[model samples]
Target chain A: MAPPKRSVPDSSANGGALSLPRQAGDQRRDPSDRAIAEACGRGEAWAMELIYHRYRRRVYGLASRIAGPEDADEVAQEAFVRILRGLPKFRGDAQLGTWIYRLAVNAALTHVTRRPRHTEGDEVLDNIPAAQTSARDPGLSARLERALVALPAGYRAVLVLHDIEGLSHEECATILECRVGTSKSQLHKARARMRELLGPALAAERKGE
Target chain B: MRCPQLQRLSSRFLDGDLGAERASAARGHLRDCERCQRAVAAEAEIVAAARSLPSSPEPAQGWDVLWGRVSARVAEEERADAARSAASLWWRENRSRLTLAVSAGAAFAFVLWGAPALPALGPGPLGLVPGSSSGGDQAVTEGGPERDGVGESLAERGARERAETDRQFREAVSELEVIIAEEQAFSDGARADAAGAELGAIRERVRGAKAARVALPDTAGRPSPRQDPVYEAYWEELATLQRAAVGVSDGEPGAGFRQDPAGRAPATGPVTGDDRGGDGPQGPGGARDSAGDGEGTR
Candidate 1:
């Protein structure tokens, strides 16, 4: 058989060589959030693209953490669409990134909460890395992950933002809409509990070694 | 900073929130006390472990899928906007033309309705006989020589009437001037009366001052003339009063004539050629003749 040729459209061929460096430089010189927001307010395509590029990763990360991998993609896209619609009313006191992260987290949380109980899939420990998983420990990582998932949504959110995400206490508090004192206390309690849950397994592993 | 306080400060301290003095106190306590130091260390370790947890992986499908959705939405919005703008531009361009067409149609209808009604209202300038029309046309044709006999007669009559009117107007003006002059005299008399009254009061005051001066014996004591400020002030006031009285009297006559107290100028004896006849004389005897003429004219 002859080698299959890659099909390319004429328009795409013509447009493929266009670079964004000059456009990016122009935008960088006038990197006004207000201008981007105003354009987004008018529903401009390029403005929406800029907004998505700026915040999509953080939004997707937050959504994946809250809703798990299955629904994370839908949750993140929905969050961006909501952000675009709400851009006109976005008061500028908080950083745009922080606002976007909060929206994504809320949307993911809401989605997960509204899902049917039976829809939660089997607890699987197969994906655990070899370094984290031992032959002797049947499902230690799985149990820890279960304990973390079992934490109340509020505590889980704060813990993830403060601990797993490595955000500052103030940043966690801003995203969770809680006081800094509450964030610190909640983080301390969550870690102590996680340690308590994991302590026996970890100790058993050491003893066996 | 031990126990409960230490517990509170432990959280703040770990979060880097303790005030300087309190933090220093906590630091000192932690250094000395092993129990609190261990607690702090344990908290730090836990926080570190929590922070060390790996973040969730990125979604398997890349941004290409999201970009596709966004591009579709953007294209739809752009098309809608373009359609709106095109419609608006079309309306703006054609609005004046539409208004002009409507206005012309309305004006033509109005003229069609109005044209027949024009003749029924009354005869216009074109309908009347030239010499036999009413007073308006007669007035207009008065100077034409086609009606030369009538025109010459009318001209003679108008000139005679105008001369008569001029004579009457002159007579009226002369009578008014005489009335004005008499009024001025009356006002002057009234002002003189008021001045006399003021003069009497001043004389009485002067007489009292003289009496006081006379009663003081010259031999008793005499203050230096320059030191008598009261006497000097009184003398100056008297001089001021006299000057004011003279000014008041002078201004009164002109104001009275301008005000015209009788309200109308008097008529004269048939207004003879002499302009001064209307004035009669500059005395009270002329008042009778002037007053009679006023009554007769009315």
Candidate 2:
């Protein structure tokens, strides 16, 4: 039988990083991810629905940013299929969230590699206004979004996971199935590439300063 | 370090990945080089812009619609898995029956492919009727003076081939009768009883086929041999009996069937009518008795 449900703090609500283990005292009663995963493994439809609801946001986010918004739906759906199908065999070696994130990231990366990169359809990224951009230089966000699209899928994946999703380098490493050092290097190169792409915007920002 | 070299280390330095010495050198260069300082600041801003990008873009078709797709895919996968499991279960239940069918098919194919070669190997016991002359040779001789060994008319060749096949089948049936009789001698179980009943049914059908074949008028001088329903039924019954007899001899249900009542290997030769009273199973009987009853009734 599944371990009895106990009160575990809901760190996701608190904007905690994706790897939410049972933590110090706070009251929010919900089933542990392992309990949910074990239930899903038993071919319980309700348990699968619960898992889909729980991780859908993070998975969709990974898909949109890494694969771009146009293909996010297809990519996220593929990831969920893999997750639910593999649930029965989901040995709890990794945290459920971490494992799901890995599957989602892998799905996104695979999608990008299999299809030609297209920067034109990502209207979501195009619409994002840089938080620090001056009113006079509104195109910075658009340029930044294009720069992300221009990077290779591997580099883009690191940036999306580590910078945008707020996953640590270790988590990025786990998801990408790369070394932590490799993750860091990819992030560095990704950011440098972004800077190179956004050179004109940066020059304007420096002038304004 | 020069400004260009310091700029190269800026990405690592921004992420705090530089070693202590390199980081200090980068810091020293950045303190004096304004261009390098602007480059690092720009790198930081790009990371900030990326972090500010919304994690989940509201899908153009909405969350509910996307969820619907996912839900359908999951159900499709579940159906596929269920189908696979069901197929596996069916295979497990019927493995022995399927093996019998496949083995029978392969054996029939082997027989069809190798049939023409049998006449070259000469005749065995059941190759001719007890009191009759060679029927196939007689048919060929009556057919014409227009024939060479290879130049025989198609009709004559088919008739001859058909007779050879029938003779070979009778010889095999005679051999199977001996094995089954010996098998029944040392075995008195339900399996042996079942085998006897099945063989009896086959003998009854064979008798019917023989009667039907005799009733048909020979329009082409000899039998057409184009379509023989008896051979089809004969093949099926032969295959079934062969499986049962082999099972008995293989020690599956009847270990005693492997040896005769005297603990000797049973005779492997075809049992003729006269020989049945001697080496065949003695006293109260099963398949052999039923076989005799079938022959007597005919």
Best candidate, TM-score-wise? 2
Given the true complex, what DockQ would model 1 score? 0.07
Which segments of candidate 1 are over 4 A away from where they belong?
A1-30, A117-147, A205-209, B1-13, B18-46, B53-56, B69-298
Give residue B186's error in model 2 in angstroms.
Answer: 32
Instruction: For each candidate in the order shown, give its overall lDDT on alpha carbons.
Output: 0.46, 0.55
Clashing pairs counted in every model = 0, 0
Native-to-model Cα distance after best TM-score fit, residue B235 in candidate 1, in Å: 92
| Candidate 1 residue pairs in backbone clash | none
Q: What are the RMSDs of all candidates, in order? A: 44.7, 26.2
lDDT per residue for candidate 1 within B1-298, as digits (tens), equals: 7766886666567766677899889888888898677567655644555544455556676776875765565466446545432222222222223222322322322322223234433323333223321211122333232122333322233233333433332343243334334434665555444444544455455455445434432211322222222233233322323322332232222111110111112132111111211111211001122221100221
Q: Could you give candidate 2's per-residue lDDT for residues B1-298 as a string of tens digits?
A: 8887876666677766678899889888888888888888888777766666665666788767877888788788667546432222222223223223323333332332233334533333323112222222223223232232455532344345445545555554555565556656765545555655656776786677677545543323322222334344444543445444433333222122122222222233112111221112211101121121111111
lDDT of 1: 0.46
| Tens-digit per-residue lDDT, A1-209, candidate 2 | 11112211132433222233444662223556666667677776666766776777788887887777778889898888778766665566766677777777766765675575465323433443444447334456556766667666777787777777777777777766677887777777777777766766577665665
